[model samples]
Target: MVVVIPKKRRDGKSSFLKLVFYLSFREDNPGDIPVTADAFFDRPSTSKIAVFDRLIDYIDRHASPESQHLITHLPDGSHRILCEGVLCQTNTLSIETASSEMNAVALKNTRCKDPVYHFFLSWPETDSPTVEQIFESARHSLKALGMSDHQYVTAIHRDTDHLHCHVAANRIHPVTYKVADDAYDISKLHKASREMELKYGWTRTNGCHVINENNRIVRSCSKEKSMPDDAKKLEYYSDQESLYGYAVRECRPEISEILKADSIYWERIHAVLIRAGLELKKKDRGLAIYDRVHPEQTPFKASSLHPQLTLSKLVPRIGEFENAPRVMEFKNEQGEVTLTNYMVSSHYDDRLHLRDHQARMTRRLERAEAREELKLRYQTDKKEAKCPSFDAKNRFRTLSMTFRFRRAHVCVAVRDPLMRKLAWHVLAFEREKAMAELRLKLKEERAHWYRAPENRRLSYRVWVEQQALKGDKAAISQLRGWAYQAKRDERTAYLSDTVIECAVSDDIAPVELKGYTHHIHRDGVILYKKEGVTQMIDRGETIEMARPFENEGDNMVAGLHLAEQKSGEKRVFSGPREYVEKACSLVRDLNEMGETSLTLTDSLQQKRVCEIRPQDKPAPISFDSPNLTP
Candidate 1:
């Protein structure tokens, strides 16, 4: 077992130190005292009962059944106490009585700086010692520390993987009444730990001070071949260490040549190491390389690989070397040698924060890109899916029919399955061609408008008026209201002009709804945003866009309005009132005309409602001749 007595701190206010102070005298459980002892005291208990009560409470709260009783000198006046289970009960009354007895003796001597001393004796993770052995060890250690006759309590705590004991000693001796001195405490602990390690046949550990100084390197060494296997230990070393291990084992000669040569060129060695996935960093402990992929792993130490690679030896050969520009160096505090400053720059902290931010943004971008790719693939797959081959014999026989629109009709013979698909394709082709012409016409008109200085002046005057109204609301109340009305009027006119431009571009062709009129604005069309929804002007009033709702009552009204305007109402229905009232009339007429619907199902009529894709279209199927109808 290894024993450690932590360094005493001047800061007495720390909570952890306070816990250790109270835990030493606490009872393992409430009211469970050994039956063999006689209660005796020399001093009054009034001045210190509460201190002992709090100590017992800390123990009871953290206690288990086995370590509750206090072990002490046998009442038979023998040196050894029974260590099986029972000691004095650690409850309030018993603790108070013991403190009074100790205080009575302490009153005879001068007060000490610390009246209580605590020690921790920890064993190996694999070992499980009995309570008797642990108390015995604590007894022997106390004797070694020259506190053999002092009254003390030992509690074995088994909460961690390693079993340990906390021993608290009252500095005042019961007989001598001399305050205990802790001079050379650390050295005594080291000697006692060595003695116990030999006695228990457990692995020995150096004093805590020595173990911490070497960065816990010696602690990793077991009494047996206690270090973890090479693969596991390598994780604690830097990437350079791993590469050094491999290189020393695999290519020792080349590395030796580079190290021994005067006026060493680092690039040559760096290039060689980079090929093997290694890069050197001048660290506080000397040259090391961290793994590129697992930088959290400790860097491999070059000196550890071979003594010649030590900073003292390597620096002489390299001579007047300039370290990597980004690696800052600082003078050694001990005046030994220069060392790399791993934590010197304030900007490095900001850089780390920025790197974390960039990493989060990169992950978001990757997810967004993945979603977009999936959407595109889905659309492509849907387009590539072939329509179920149309059949005429069992499903629908070909029939000569006349399809009529207002003042226009066509007669043809087609199977029901093919008829819907054929008509949709014809309409799509016509619409695409008309939109192309519309785009060209819009470009020409925009050019013409920009060429007119009067149009530009009018736009600038409107902007200036709006800005003036916004600057001082109180001064321009009536003018502001008038300006707002004028702005609305201007927007309405712009929307109406856009609709006229569309009409002129397509040569007054009837508008077809392909669901593209919402959200997006083409060259000749403008969609105004309002109340988080897209809006457009049909006449003078604002109309909410619903281009995709083709079979709805509102859509039918829009289509009728388009068709009637194309024929003769084009010049007459220019104002908002005329356009809105005409649309209401169209909706009434359409409702009176009744309704018709074409329902397509998945299994039998899946592809009948789709427009044709030119690349995947089958050979043209000729229609049978029929008499024309109008």
Candidate 2:
């Protein structure tokens, strides 16, 4: 597995944030991971002035959906996880690319040994930490890490019921007021998480590393096949008078001492042969042939055995032999034997972290694009029909009627089928994301109503209109919230351009970044860093922004200023005593007029109750119309 300790550079930090928030993905995505930034943010609903605050609030919410994210397996057997998307990042991120706020995280005076800001962890959808469980665990972990900032952890979009938890952390320790170098015992966090995953019965695999230099290559001999097999051996070559004299004088004593440990070690003396110009490898072994004619580069001929001796001739002359070795021996019919054996060494390889990071980025982007595509499915008009005849106050009473009028996607059983209907669950979150794609078998008659010609339409206008009925003020507030959120998102997009710098491991050449290395030590990389000259992220980078001119709030006195805003009307209505006193005569008249309708309804209900008392109560209420809309 590869874990990257990203360099703490302000420029890189900018790009990191930018890549995270400006993320894009296809709304029709079939895989997981949010590629585009919008998948993590809420659409803007508030005025530009408040959008930043709305975004920040969202980021802090610790959002969670029914299932956290979708997972896609790559061809190489790795995976990508697409977490639920958001409408904005302003709620969680403090750096405003805009002018009103300081980009404190991007300061010049800050020491940045550890600058980890936001974290988004995802796992396969097939296995997971339950939404509630994840919420608790994430909160506990973040708090244990000493991050009490509520805004830092969020379980967003649970209402739409997609699963995903996000944390936006400040790398600097608030209490110590020290920048976390990330060189600390951060493994403890992952270990603890693994323990928790085990406790919760979740599957976990921390993937593999993929660097080019960590693998092996083959080598070939310079004049291998051209030489005879017998010519490949060079036992008696050292027996030559001059060679034997030089070896006895310069090396025989040392060689004899080493041979004391293993007499057969000479069988594996290929390395020595190569050095003395008698052996060559078979493939492209990263070494070049120095001289084909050199005895050192070519094999020694067996015919050149010293003293012109043969095995039988030498053995008879040498007489008795001691220490007959435990070599691999084969017996003939007469029990005479011959011996032979060979050996090779054993080792494993390693990979690079940078290569892994780039690969991960690529896979992540692919899955993100898919989830974004699904998000656009929401733009289609597939909302359940509303029953104007029935009041929401008694939603349950119209169950039967709703059934009759229900759309294909609508279901009304109290039983939660989330487990059985994974697609339905997924779509629920996608719908909340807005203006995304959802594939559906089209109803020819309903084609015009769907967003795409193949299916149906979901209108942004209609959603707003229906919610508007909740309360004029509430609707307006929600709208403004969305508007404000959009602005914050634009600001966060600025962080994607920062530059980051980190070095290669010492055992590896600097060229390893773009080339390759062969050595693989038992110990992994020893991280050494070059601290940047700056100490803090610049907060002033964004402070110059003026108050939004177009979205400025009403400036008149509180009550009057709110009139056009609609919320003012609610405030005035709360003072019923004063209004009632002013309209006392009108109220009296209205009370007398309401008795006619009230009396008629009461009489009809009484008659129905009397009739149903003898049998069953009549269906409590009629269903809303099947073809109705806001």
Candidate 3:
């Protein structure tokens, strides 16, 4: 959450001296500061004073003891020589190397040689180091910035702490200084900062968002609804645009404001001051490359706040004063004692998960890629198997031709099952229409004088009368029977009482019905003439058949055919039991071939199904005089 405020963010509202005022006062009084600072001392840092004072006020009101401490930078002008304080400034540098060359690009893209840029360096008390360590670390950090194709240069000033450093690097390549190609160029720097922080555990004190996939939609739903429980994960989804008073440009949201007709992305980020609340500042055109969202969230700036609250006094107030203030001490009675400087053991460790997760991800990616390569090599001419020239292996090949399709279903669980159950109601309606046509055609085949359905003027009553006059007994009976069945079918099919008399029914012509049912459909799930039984399976419903036969013919030839829903346009498996069993098995195999199975995805299929084969079949006996069943 480290954010930088550009010079143009405000009209010199927060300066270096004022920043100092805030910090100095924060040490004295918690948040008790006048809105206006009429009483003032002519200190060198006015903005820094204001910033420090605000920070103290913020900490006193909001920060916990564990959270409130200030990181300081020892500016270049305070060095001394031979016990004599010098007016001249001396600067040093330090750099760190990254493990992976790919990750080292950030350090390679910056170029800086100036001293004032030291304004950004963190100045912890012990950061100062010997001149040798300073130059060596500087070279490492510079190498991190990179050079060449996409390279940068960095200069560090480590003279302050034992090994403290400042990196003045450009966001773009040093030789090219390439302008960013996004909504803004500064975002590049923000991303670079984030990469550095994540890869290296650098702490940023600005507001941070919790990284999650569903953050935005979940936030919107919770905000719009009365969801107290949903609010827990909402914290990390917000953006941090302010630090003390600096503006950070990140997380612009797409919104359609009241006055605006079209939608535009609005800058939505918060500023962090110990106790400051959320701020929803809007940017009309969106953030520019160098633009800061809202720079002066607080009333002060940094340069003015540093001096009076030196590491010496402010440390005790925040209660983080680490080193003893005692320069030298002695005691003499019967014995004498003297003091010398000694370093405390360090208590810090690097983030281990960062490296570990990266390694796992890389390995999995390599495995996936290897699988892809194997498939590619086998697809040389998929036109023919084994080039016919190598007919020896035509039945089988040593190399696997397996591939993972991009859209292959790996695994699925239905989120809503009821919707699926409702959809099957339509299928029942279609079957009913087909059944009615089949009955009508049977009457026509008996020479019943029924007008063609194509004739709009022919009424159902008139058609029945004409058929009855022809003296076709079978035709009359079937006509009557079909009418009753159609009504029954329509009533039994739907979830609601309403029946569908749609185009499929009305469009069935009298002539078309003559041979409309030349091929009978016997879906295994719902067949009216299946084994002297009529089945009506609901959507998501499945049927299992007991193995009826387990033997083949000795002197008799046996044929076992598997049928799935009579091979109709809509497969429902209302056919013979043997056919049904085979259909289900084949389908199960196809489903298992997929990484994610169809049955797993189907919300209606809530129960598990398994079918076991007998593995042995008795021989069937055949007799010409007397038919013997196996």
Candidate 4:
């Protein structure tokens, strides 16, 4: 069992309505709320609660009638509602009324920042609990958290591999307007999960709290053993074992045995570690195991692998620290190490390319460092030069003006008009030249002082994305691995699949056509925008509107046409009957206008030619044709 409390939005704001809406629908299709009105109204009720009745009434009035059958079917042939409302308030209120009341109560609390608590409880795939069991578990978990009296909305979602229930509880009490105490919520949730697992005889899962031998819940003291954070993230994103993890898994037992021997020596440990492509070295105040192949990467802390490997412990056992030999021969042949930088094992060529790119980046970083040093040197020189202060410079300028005026007076005192004029001219030329030189010097100094450094470096993920955009298969694979690790929804997963083959063509490039602007993303995902609004997304193999709008039919037809133009092939539009009909109608219109020649084929491969004849109107397309597949 896993219980997760999602963090609040980055802005630290909570909206009950938005959370409810998200819980009520599938991530891909927001237009349809999968919960039926009947199922919602059939929920257990303590009284004819006005709030609950109001919410049901609202759903009945606005919810789609066809939503009653929106149950999702698995490939195994079992069907279940994608999302079902399991429980609400004891008074049985609708989602809208509950949100409204919760928002109203939240307004009374001026101190509380986050007014909503959104948490989810999930069971393993092996267990398939009924709706009543799920509801009871949610009620039990909430009651254990001291949120029994608070307004909350709970729904069961079966869209994923595991069965899970989402609970959105208002932190502020509806009547008292006091925020619920959420201290130790994680421990409380874990305790609740343990209880539910026991009560239902479900599969047991580890948590922070566990039942002791005395049959009482106690805080678990067992240390959680796992890969290092960086190593774990690398494994997750690259689908390869990290160097630290590899050392721990493959080399730890032998190293531990060596440490356990009667005469523990540093040579024996170093030999074993080296055989595994690892080296033990002193780092900081402790020892660390560094990857032999990629020394630039982070190393594993010695104590993290085994307590006895610590510098203090090992020093006491072996007398003192001893460095490994520069070269050593092993009786057994050394096997090749699978781990590399970022734990990338597959796609060796791509790995080499990435390494080369990183090398270039390292050179860039070196240049940036050199520039920084130069900048600092320039700053130091400027400081040591002791340039004139602002006040001193102003005073000097005044003195110079006074000297010039005195010089002019001296020229006038000569009592020769021609000599005085010539002296003034010479002084003006000298002053102009001096001012120009000063201006040029100040401009150069300003340029040097404000020159920005080229220290920008792209992160690994961003670099991979850039490579993927350039149609690198390995980069695309790495991105897909990341998406898989993220557990993105089905639509996003499909979009992240193998990159579609896109033939280079100037016609398909980003440009405005018939008021719609086309934009292509990585892996040939095309987006059609109009007036700065995204209208549709064409993922080469599939096309979907961004949202349902009045002109969705037009957008759909336009997307199909654009996709065809880009692919240089005839495209078949497959979707709801209405959308297909609209596309066929548009195609017929285009054919009748003598602008494009096209033919519509039925399911039986019978093609109907659309011929432009100004003398007679064309026959209307038959939707009820027996041969048509719509």
Measured over all alpha carbons after superposition, the RMSD of each candidate to the real structure, in angstroms, is 39.4, 37.0, 41.5, 18.3
Task: Put down candidate 3 lDDT per residue, 1-630, tens digits, no spaces.
Answer: 233333322332322223222212222211111111122112333354455554455435453434333222234322211101101112211111111121233334344221111113232343334443443343343333342123222223222222233333323442454422223323433444444434444443222222234322111122221212222122112111123212111111111121132321111111221112223322332211111223333322221222222334333444332222222335478565554332111111111111112223343243334434433533542323221222323312311111112112111232345643444454446545645665566556433322333322323333333433343322222232233222222222322111111111111111111111111111111111224332221111222222223222100001111122111112233345444344344345444556223232222221222442334222335564366543
Candidate 2, after superposition: displacement of residue 267 in Å? 7.8
Candidate lDDT scores, in order, read 0.43, 0.31, 0.27, 0.58
Q: Rank the candidates by TM-score, best first.
A: 4, 1, 2, 3
Question: Which residue pairs in model 4 clash with each other?
Answer: 52-93
Off by more than 4 A, model 4 = 7-11, 14-17, 29-63, 68-92, 211-217, 223-244, 253-265, 312-316, 323-483, 486-630
As a TM-score, model 2 comes out at 0.24
What is candidate 4's CA lDDT for residue 217?
68
Please, what is the TM-score per model? 0.32, 0.24, 0.16, 0.46
Question: Can you write out model 4's per-residue Cα lDDT over 124-173, one digit (the tens) per residue?
Answer: 97888887788678778888888877777777876565778888888887
Candidate 2 wrong stretches, greater than 4 Å: 1-12, 15-102, 105-109, 113-120, 124-126, 148-166, 173-178, 204-630
Clashes of each: 10, 124, 88, 1
Model 1 lDDT tens row, 152-225: 65556553456777776666777777776788776677666666666666664655323334333232232212
lDDT accuracy of residue 389 in candidate 2: 31
Clashes of 1: 10
Candidate whose TM-score is highest: 4
